[model samples]
Target: MKVAPAPSKAEVISLGCRLNISESEQIRALLADENNVVVINSCAVTSEAVRQTRQAIRRARRNRPDARLIVTGCAADIEREQLSAMQEVDGLIANTQKLDSRAWNVPASSRPVLAQHTRAFVTVQNGCDHACTFCIIPKGRGSSRSLTISEVLSDVEHHLSQGAAEVVLTGVDVTSWGHDLPGQPSLGQLVHAILERFPELSRLRMSSLDGVEIDTDLFDLFAGEERVMPHLHLSLQSGDDLILKRMKRRHSRKDAVDLVRRLRKYRPDLAIGADIIAGFPTETEDMHAQNKSIITELGIVHGHIFPYSPRPDTPAARMPQVDRAIIKQRAAELRAETQKCRDRWLINLIGTEQQVLAEKDGTGYAPSFARIQLPEGTPAGRILNVKPKKLEKGLLK
Candidate 1:
């Protein structure tokens, strides 16, 4: 008996970060030619990712009324019950294994799957053991688990065969990767393994990392390898020790500072960035000032600030809530302080050489934590050596 072919499709999409974007690209490539099947990759990190996801879905539904929709990713993972109940979505996938079109509840089309972009995200690990008070990822994703080395290597080989320009290793706790392996594989070992097995991989980027994961041996790997990008994103929620304790963060202010110092020592040209929560519950004015001062003293290249949003089922949520007025005020102040530091950094870069990966839309270069806006007609999606000619306040030069 001959099997019949599936129909064609369109897709809606959203991405959380570099890693999310990478994985989502792969998902879209798989669903690209379903003729009438559509996929919408959703994100729910900040308020912005959610807004973007909704907007993308709305546009997809409007443009292709007959297309079957598959919504998946962090946003959907956290709210699976809610997402599955949505009238628009025919299917949803969390931080799960790559499911075929058969499970998608949509008939498969005979159209060929394609490569989405120049780079791809190969997630070797998919869960988190750490439970930061403010985070809800563990709720969405289960306990720490890793994909077999063979599984990951197979994906890497396939990526190289498909001509991937780069691969970003992604996970909730990428540093804790290989912990569940038989020999308890370390991050350095996995990195070395990938490099040795796939010499064609030009560049490999790490997703977000934590201070607890920093070690001298890992830095040796970075120092020994040029394929690793000279960039790092460390999660540092607060600079005040008391606030950190309250937030139940495993790392202290000193730990974060030391991590930055060590990374920069190894790679002088490294662009360092941090995440911050401006107003945790019961955080006082002095504590906020301490947090601001620490960031300024560390000389981080930039900061991504978030006003404290209490999530349900977290210890921090039950703590005495600070007045909304106070939270808002502190958030604004932290933002302003961080803005000054960022602007000063940009100002100094007016005459420096940088490797910039520009976008195809001829938009601008998102160099680490900052965005560099050039003349609109400039070429997109090319890594070019750029010299900052001038500075326009805090954003770009």
Candidate 2:
């Protein structure tokens, strides 16, 4: 006799970076067969992020009244008691526990459904070793840990076999991968291994990487590798040296500039992106000017501009704070500058051939990570080579 398939029983609402999104997939796999479970994979990068998380929790509770709402991620880990007190949150899982089979109460499984995603994000590393004075993530994510090279290759192979055209290596601090493992293999070695093992893998990408920790091998890969995507989003918190020092960031303004210049020398078309915080404590006008100037100087085509919002217990929170109004204004100005850079890049791409990974509804992303509107009815997950004839509504046509 034939049997009916099981119904959908779980849902995950991810509210953070690519790393969180990648982990949410694992959480979804763990709860795939369970009933009435809703997981809130939260973010706590800033106080605003924590507030948004709370809002998400309330919304999730309203929508899924019958489901058991589980909260997990940086916010949940750091603010356990506070989140636990929320009536909507039924359980709390730490960032470390999210990957543990025991936490899910299920047999260890590798069968993850990519579900509506053409690209698969394989988390090879987690947590951070360095403590940036402005960051609370290390507290939530714990010390650096890495999956062995073989384990990472296995996951990559699994995703490739499941028809993933692109595989992105994601983590809390991806560049710190392999430090906790045998021989302390570098991230570049891991990338080399993945490429060597799976020659047919279409595209390989990395999430945000710290500029200071990038190694020689990784630099060579960026210079010459065609398979590794040309878009790099850097974890550059500030472009001012004084701000960098205050934030306890390893890379200085000169370091960031030199890195970008070197990469662009090899791959001129490389799309550079960075996370810059505006109005950090004690930031003078001259410092803010330097921050604004770096975008143009480095040709940053993509930017994640964040208004400085202090988190409780972080060292920066105790520093003399910037006025809220000035912070917002500086953030706005930085965003405008970023937009100009992006528009300039987009203008340059006009009439150039773009390798677009078609996502949903005739929309996709180009190699430079720019949005492209493909011919209507173009199916998702198909990589198409087409010349972008013009720009339409901020998207390449």
Candidate 3:
């Protein structure tokens, strides 16, 4: 069998989440042997994110003076004209176009070099249908769509062939998958299908999920499937009931707490993570306190804390604004609390044996997604059975 040639030197600078990283791999494959081209797959979750994207474009141009630079991703889709106005950018591609091979004039035979060796992120779904008041993602990503079951299985086979130990299903709204497909299958069905088809797949993981949409099959898999990783990152934006309502989020504090509690009952070692926004429009001190308390109450070891930044044209941007100083302060407080939670979890794992997938430079991640530094010269992409002896800095030693 003829092996695909190694990826060429074309640069792909990815910003934002794992979904963008997955798409960047495709961009790299499409533009592989092409000369003097740099692709910036951007993120536009917040205004600060967009600013950083622009800064990256400038840095890329300065470093490679003659390269033809192209910008794509959510930022390009939402603010095409603004990015086009920048002198450094030679072309612009939309979020949808980024995944389509025809947009890059490349054949469909080109396959992505999934990043980090140990794991591959397969984008099973895209876009969001829910209209959360603070979000601009649906406008940037358009309506939700999904890849067919066969298409996803093919990709999984390819990844496993390349020796990926884990495959993480990613999307703009992962739980919203299959709504556009035949029979209106649930995300749970997709998970069950993947596991059934590929019994050899060692580990399967998922990106962020919305608490409200998790179906019965998924919950059962969470409870009984040992192959599925025990960590879950939830899209729990706020913990205050009034703030959640104001943000148009689907779940309340009680709902989130109850879901975590129930999942923990099924798998005692389950590690819960969450995304929280600090100081949304009209948020008060009591509301921020509730957000802080829920981090401890729910035992969320992994926390993605974002200081609320109003995006242009979003409903929250037009609502009564929180003071910038207050937002910064509240975000700091949340970060500090998150550190304490993380530390407590790590300390609890001191003498436990963990199955770790080595990523690079003698470092790997346990099933709970905690980083662990291993013995020297351990090959990347190898899974090892390790007994964590100590906590050094923030990593397991």
* The best candidate in terms of lDDT: 3
What digit string (tens of lDDT, one per residue) describes model 2 on residues 306-361?
A: 99998889999999999999999999999999989999899899899889999977
Q: What local distance difference test score does each model get?
A: 0.71, 0.89, 0.90
Could you tell me every candidate's TM-score relative to the true structure? 0.83, 0.96, 0.96
Pick the winner on lDDT between candidates 2 and 3.
3
Specify the poorest-scoring 10-residue window by lDDT in model 2: 108-117
In model 3, which runs have C-alpha deviations exceeding 4 angstroms?
1-8, 107-116
Model 2, which residues run further than 4 Å from truth?
1-8, 110-116
* Model 1 stretches with alpha carbons more than 4 Å out: 1-8, 45-65, 84-102, 105-116, 363-382, 393-397
True-structure lDDT of candidate 3: 0.90
Instruction: Output the better candidate (1/3) by TM-score.
Output: 3
Per-residue lDDT over 1-397 for candidate 1, one digit per residue giving the tens place of the 0 to 100 score: 9888655445536566655666666666666544676677676655556667777777777876777777877777776776677677777766564345555544555433446445567887876898777777677667888887888888877776776666778887888887888998788778888888887675787777776775556677666577777667677888999999887788888888777677678676666667888778888889989888977877766677877877657778888888878878887887788777777777777677766656555534443434675566665545666677777655555
Name the candidate, 1 or 2, with the larger lDDT value: 2
* lDDT score, candidate 2, position 375: 91
lDDT of 1: 0.71
Query: For candidate 2, what is the TM-score?
Result: 0.96
